[model samples]
Target: MAVEVVSGIVLGSREYGERGMVVQLYTRELGRVGVMSYAGRGNDGAKLSPFLRVLSTVRVALRLGRHAEGMPKLVDVEEWERGAQRGWSCEKMVVGCFIGELIQRLLEERVPNEDFYLFLLERLGLFAAETQDEVVFLMVFLLDLAKSLGYAPQGEYTVSNRYFDVAHGAFCGRGEGEGADVIAGADAAVWGRLLDGHYLADLHDVDGSQRCRVLYQELRYLEVHSGLRLSLRSLEVLKELVG
Candidate 1:
């Protein structure tokens, strides 16, 4: 098999056997891939562990699956960037874990999306930088991820039509069906600002409580649209932090 080289960020991993493990990575060239690595066995094992940590970016050489649908084997890995291993706060780590889990759940294996890949890279870098509000960043990331996945809310907010209909993915007038997905005008405006691509720095003036509300609404939107019960363990930690 021909060796393929790709740059990727580790999403998550699980121990497969006593010595081997399955690592999930979102690659620049191949999107999300699951490869088997022996991380408990040789000298390379020690080196691979750190590089495979969640959100760690690396360049790797892979031995492609022989049957095309089989699992690929990890040949080697090189760290692309390094940051403080233990410097991340509890909030940051939880948010990072949530993002990783969300990506792993939403994307299909071996399906490549270059734009989404780049977006993930940038967001991960921002998280690593640790200069922004983690909760606010997470809310923005969820909105952006929804846009990438094609379920982002549509239509511009106007004075007359300000309510965001999460079920319909659009702005509508008040008294719009009274579903649990309909966000209030204030919250709808916040979602609009985020969907319009406002940076976290620009939104820094927004109160943390409002940000948390917007995030909850966005997560509900995702749940309604994607039909997946998202894992909220990390989100619980974030809620406590923000409050």
Candidate 2:
């Protein structure tokens, strides 16, 4: 088998047998992959434990095509030193898990999207810093993710046509069928600002309730486009944390 070294972030993990684990990783070179690792009770287990932590970044040596069914085997793992040990607050942890789950659900297996991988890395850094408005950060990240998936809401906003048609993923004028999917009025205006590249710092004047409303609209837009019920488990936790 050919051995390859790659950088990845742990998306999730589960125990296998008595001394091994099956881990889901989002790799820079291989999009998403499942690898098996043996980490029994000893120094070896201690060394590999960090790699199983959700959102932990690591350099791993994978024995490609090791399994008869063609699953990769994890030969070795080393946690990257840069910002590796920064402790995340409870809120950050929940948000990070939510992001990981979203990626795992939305992406296909073994399809490399380097831009999205780099975007995750950048957002991880920002989360580690823990200095920005977390709610706004998440909203922006979701918008960017939607764009990467090729179904982001249209950024064309006019004073007259301020209603965001979520089902169509565009801004529209006041008309019939302006119900849940049609974000109109003040909510539409805020959503437009987010799509126009206004970051958290630029949105200081906006209050928390309005930010939450925009976030909900953005999520609804994504659900409409992707056709996936992203009823994320950590969503309630995130909402409580942000509020």
Candidate 3:
């Protein structure tokens, strides 16, 4: 009907035409939105990169009578955050891309998930801001993401039973639960901290490889529990690079 203008963050974009690029964005008001911009190339191409984190003041032309599906036109894109010019290690960049893809796949557009939206923004900003010690950040981000996705494993850690079955996301001591692997206290402590929201802010003193292991475990747990089929190529590359 009428054109509506809104502010949105550029989640990802790719070439769609000789000059136009299709952009996916997360808006505070509209959730995930797709915009096709013809003027998004060249010197401004930096604005279309994945996780460019730009804000667009867009003029949207909506199609009527398409309650569930229809393409909307986006006009007047503007750079909001200016995520360019910052140097990120390859691993950091990969992680950022992974986060964007994860959101794009798991989250439905037009539905409000404010908590998840805020969490993603914060975590992305954390990745961008932290120049050192990203392993901890990755671990913490995954754990928090699991919780948000409702796939967080359940457990309580005690001195008597400290090992966690990576698949179960729970503690299994000697002779306990069938098919449960022994859980280590260190892993349990890390998980326990996750329950407290401490893990989201930082991973403390853990090393890079160790962080990768934890991420693998958490992702495996999510795969088994949530059944969300996600490719780990980027994560695997990051792990090998850091290790």
Candidate 4:
């Protein structure tokens, strides 16, 4: 018996070989899957790259009465979003790859998150558009993703406070005649804006160093809350350009 399914293409093969190649894909239905194929070669090989959306109909063979391994086999492959690839429409292609790698690492394998898959698919579409502000775009993506992954920051804040508690993932409240132990003032303002899905672009009145500090603070919050470290290559690129 065999089963067939349509899955969203996440990432896959990027190697040259005799037969074909080994690729990894994050499918909406099957989660993370590995495929070995001889079909994608030359022109086909180029199309089989990471995030080259494709439709795969696979056949699963079960070994009975014998000690053997079982994995689904690809019976047919079809291009899904064939025209989605343009040059580098958004940030550099490398930055996009970095984002994809982060997603691939953070997401668990074989877990059902149809909503997340769809959200990611839409994000890819938006990233491809390249019309929006990339800095704001990344911050929005981070905040939304953080909330989804159970890292919604504690909103407790006050005008008199001064530091954000990274480990607690919250804005520390002002105490009696004193600021909170962690976050306060400008950091509180930034955190409040992030929680509200507001873009940081509006805060240009603040010094760039202050902005970078807030970004670093958020990064620490994400690390403590999600146990994932983003490569932040895009941030580095921005820093180099500014310097």
lDDT (10s digit) by residue, model 3, range 1-243:
222222234343454322211223334344433443323434322333343443322232222222234522222222233244244444454455455544444542223255655666565555556445555566667767778766666676667666676666676675564553444657666666655654344564666666666667676666676665554443544455445
**Per-prediction CA RMSD (Å):** 13.4, 13.6, 14.0, 15.2
Q: Which stretches of candidate 1 lie over 4 Å from their true place?
A: 1-86, 108-112
Instruction: Write one digit per residue (lDDT tens) for candidate 1, span 1-243.
Output: 211122234343454222222223334453433432333333222234333434442332223222355533333222332344345554554455456556655553224355665666676666667556677778778888788767877887888788888888888888874777788767777877787764454676668788878878887888788754554443554555565
TM-score list, all predictions = 0.62, 0.61, 0.56, 0.54
Question: In order, what lDDT does every prediction score?
Answer: 0.57, 0.54, 0.49, 0.47
Candidate 2, residues 1-243: lDDT per residue as tens digits? 211122234333354222222223334454433333322233222234334433353332222224465544333223322245355443444455456555555642323255655665565556556556666767778887788777877757788788888888888887943677888888877776777643454677677778767777777777788854454333544454455
Clash totals for all candidate models:
0, 0, 5, 8
- Which of the numbered candidates is closest to the native, going by highest TM-score? 1
lDDT of candidate model 1 versus the reference = 0.57
> How far in Å is the alpha carbon of 231 misplaced in model 2?
4.1
- Report the lDDT tens digits of candidate 4 across residue range 1-243: 122222234433445322211222234354333432323424222334443454322222211121134423323223332233434332333234345545645653223255655666666556555534555555566767677666777655566444466666765555532323355677667667666764334655556576556665666666777777754433454333222
Worst 10-residue lDDT window for candidate 3 reads 58-67
Question: Which candidate do you rate higher for TM-score, 2 or 3?
Answer: 2
